[model samples]
Target: MKREGRGEQSAGPSRTEGLEEAVRQADPDRALCAGFLPASVRADVTALLAFHTELTRALAPARSAAIAGPMAGLIRLQWWRDVLEGVRTPDHALAPAILSALARGVFHRETLLRVLRAREAELNPEPEVSPWRQMMRDGAGGVQRAVGEALGVRDEAVLTRLEASGAAYGAGAMLRHWPHIQQSGRYLFPGETAALRQEGEAFLQSCDADTLPPAGRLAALPAVLAARDLARTSAQAGQPRGLGDRLAVMRAGWKAARMFQKSGEPAL
Candidate 1:
């Protein structure tokens, strides 16, 4: 649900310091869990998460001069699309990892683009729970689908489980991010909020932890965090903000990491 800024570790401490700070603010979930993976796996996951964070932020209502308004959002989305299309070189910080993934034939360009398009469409108001759930599905499922592919899990059933996890995570984020979305001139109806919350809980419950491959479970850390957040909050409530949310994310990451230590069971 979060994407942190990532600086190359090879960079000097000063350069990494800023990235670390930004990452801490954006994707604490990734920063905390990276240590649980092997160094090589950590780098790949970090790059994927970084690009996800960029797209997530870019899709939001622009806050600064760098990317402002709906048109700007489309421009940035197109830039990313171009990166995937290979028409233009990847010029962004996270583009390298994405390009590498592409070169290796692991990236899911269509799903990623759908994720971005879903995000772009979110600028419009979501008045119903069904439409909101659909958006959440594409946004989060896009990443999980890509992660599963990159991990080389080809079972359609397993990928379906990952999709459920992604939808659950996205729905919770929609609830948690409701206030911010409102501040950006978009409104979420109370009925829609309740629907989103309920659907998130349902999707999380539907995900059988026993169904995921070990690598797939690793790709599911965000859903784990979402389930935890849902558990800790009321059905009609938003995820706890600030410190509470941070603590919740860490707790979820810890839970997901523990799953890796188990024997033959990677479901959840």
Candidate 2:
């Protein structure tokens, strides 16, 4: 997983731009997908992704230690949970935008809480693959559904497909991050790398991207890119970095847009 940055610590809306930029830098894959969203909701989608970035980064310091590190991460997680629950006003720069999205009903509050809880599970390093699997399903899967809903996908089948594809991408990402995470003395998905990789591949094999609606394809685009990387790399390989990653995302987006355009659906 990419390390999340400590975005501008300021509280007001004035610093929102800086925090959003930091999120863009830290989570380029989702941010790149967000760019393909309709202009009406593009910024809101980025705000939702910013929340994801904050949760992932919160665990950075804890990756090196077992107990105490996770404890510290829990405190950070609680602050976010409380902020979302309205128990306290947000003290972070990205909060305003997130709150605005919430106010506009971009995604349900309970759904976001599920994502938070899923991430909370990540703080405690587990020896079994089940915990990590649940994390990906609820964490990344929930995020894709939320973003898809924000993009005007209302069908339950489409939402389910989005969730499945996103979870597969999460599995791929976990595979990519396994080596680096192990170096930190933590085993997030201990002993199941091969099984997980197989699971992701199976999911992708069944997911026909050409049949998905344009919005659904965009929602699952990261997984498409991840599948390509997995095709050429080993279980321990890292995701495409920097320029290569950007070009890969751009090419995928263009191809997807063209496909949808040919089908008479709106282009991505």
Candidate 3:
């Protein structure tokens, strides 16, 4: 994570701010909704999101000399894994806060393990489609699940929705990165783009339509962004989002907040 601390002070960034920066970079749409986060578990949720970003970037394909490869990613991941599992405690920006959260059962070793596995797989995944989707599910779903857990949600049905929402988030990532991919002069997508769109939509529709609790909706709001972008992609293939599209993201956040405030259902 070469990103400098933007929300921090002289010594270092606060744990929550560190996480907020990560989300702001990884998916600005999600950052737009950070104001909707309830204060109680904000730190925990942000830390989980930030940690997931770290894993994703660690193993990301090297598009430049600056980009780290699988071996470097594995070392960083091992540090996080050891910290989370209590195997070796180390002083770091996120370790202490994350440890405290884990102590309270905000996230378990199992989910973090799956997250690691999926991220590692991204380094060199099978050509087959099923394994790819499963990697998406494990990586994205694990992050969403952690956010939901921070909200104190334990319903199995609602938990299932988080995973689907996560998969939608995965598709949104591809669409979001399209401009950058082309700029890098190496643009490609796996499988049929239409099928990928449906995969995202199907996972989204699989979620219940009813309103969710504020924190619950906050945890699931990425699904809305995914659905919106997928719709735009299908309607106008290869169109880059403009300022209007950016404003729409902010509007969606406002509307999503209103939905939770009024009736627990998002209008977007």
Candidate 4:
């Protein structure tokens, strides 16, 4: 617990902008899609994504046994909890951005709490698809809701769709990183690979990008790309995405941004 916000407050805007650029490079697909959003909305979304990145990195060392132990990771997780609870300011590079988002009321505390809860569960993973699915929904889907709120979208129906999309994207990502995850000694349910792919495909079939509102469409970018990648011929885990794929994602993002500009807000 530290009271170091005075300096961060003075440098918040520039530091947050830097963090947003880092997030964009780290997660290009979502970043490309997010580029279509208004500047303020994109900044909020970047802050949310930065928090997600923090959670993942907090556990990485322990997961790989490359640093201290699981206890070290647990401590890191608790630090975030303290920050979110206003117990103290976080001591991390991403703190300024996250704090700025909170100041603007762009983030949902409950949703972020759910995300941290889900990440904590990953330390000792159960070898079952049911719980794993729940984790994906809570972790990734909660992020979607937070971003939707940042975009000024308060519709429950739209949020629900975004949740499902985020879950599907998370599943697809797990499948794509199967080899790396297995190398980390994490547990995966027997036959879960096929199940994950199936669930992702099912979501793809049901998702209608055209039906999403402009802001909603920006929020759905990662999921849309995930579905398309999973549907590729001979697709499998650990396969590298090509230049063609990047181009396609760019095209979709451009189209979505244009649609958003054309239609400010529609009742739906």
Model 4 clash pairs are none
lDDT of 3 by residue, 1-268 (tens): 1323432221224546656766777755555545565555566666666677777666544434345645665676777778777788657776666666665666666777788888777666577767877787788877776777766667777776777787777776566565565566332346667777777777778654245555466677777667777776543344544676666666665765565556543211
**TM-score winner:** 4
The residue-by-residue lDDT of candidate 1 on 1-268, one tens digit each, is 1222342222224323345446556766555544454343445555666667887777555544434556776688878888878899767766766665555555566767777777676655466667766676677776676666665657877776777787777666657666666666543433755666788888776666545667667666667567665554444343334565566556655655566556443221
Superposed by TM-score, candidate 1 places the C-alpha of residue 260 at a distance from the truth, in angstroms, of: 4.9
Off by over 4 Å in 4: 1-13, 66-69, 187-190, 205-207, 233-240, 266-268
Q: Candidate 2, residue 195: CA error in Å?
A: 1.2
- In order, the Cα lDDT scores of the candidates are 0.62, 0.70, 0.65, 0.70
Determine which window of 10 residues in candidate 1 has minimal summed lDDT.
1-10
- How high is the lDDT of residue 243 in model 1? 68
What TM-score number comes out for model 4?
0.84
**What local lDDT does model 2 show for residue 243?**
76
Over the stretch 48-160, how does candidate 4's per-residue lDDT look in tens digits? 78788788777776767745767777788899999888797777777766766665556667878888877887876777767876777678777876777777778788877
| Better model by lDDT: candidate 2 vs candidate 3 | 2
98-156: candidate 2 lDDT, tens digit per residue: 76566656667876887888878887657676676667767887788787777667788
lDDT of 2 at 142: 78
TM-score of each: 0.73, 0.81, 0.76, 0.84
Question: Relative to the unseen true structure, what is the C-alpha lDDT of residue 189 in candidate 3, on a scale of 0 to 100?
Answer: 44
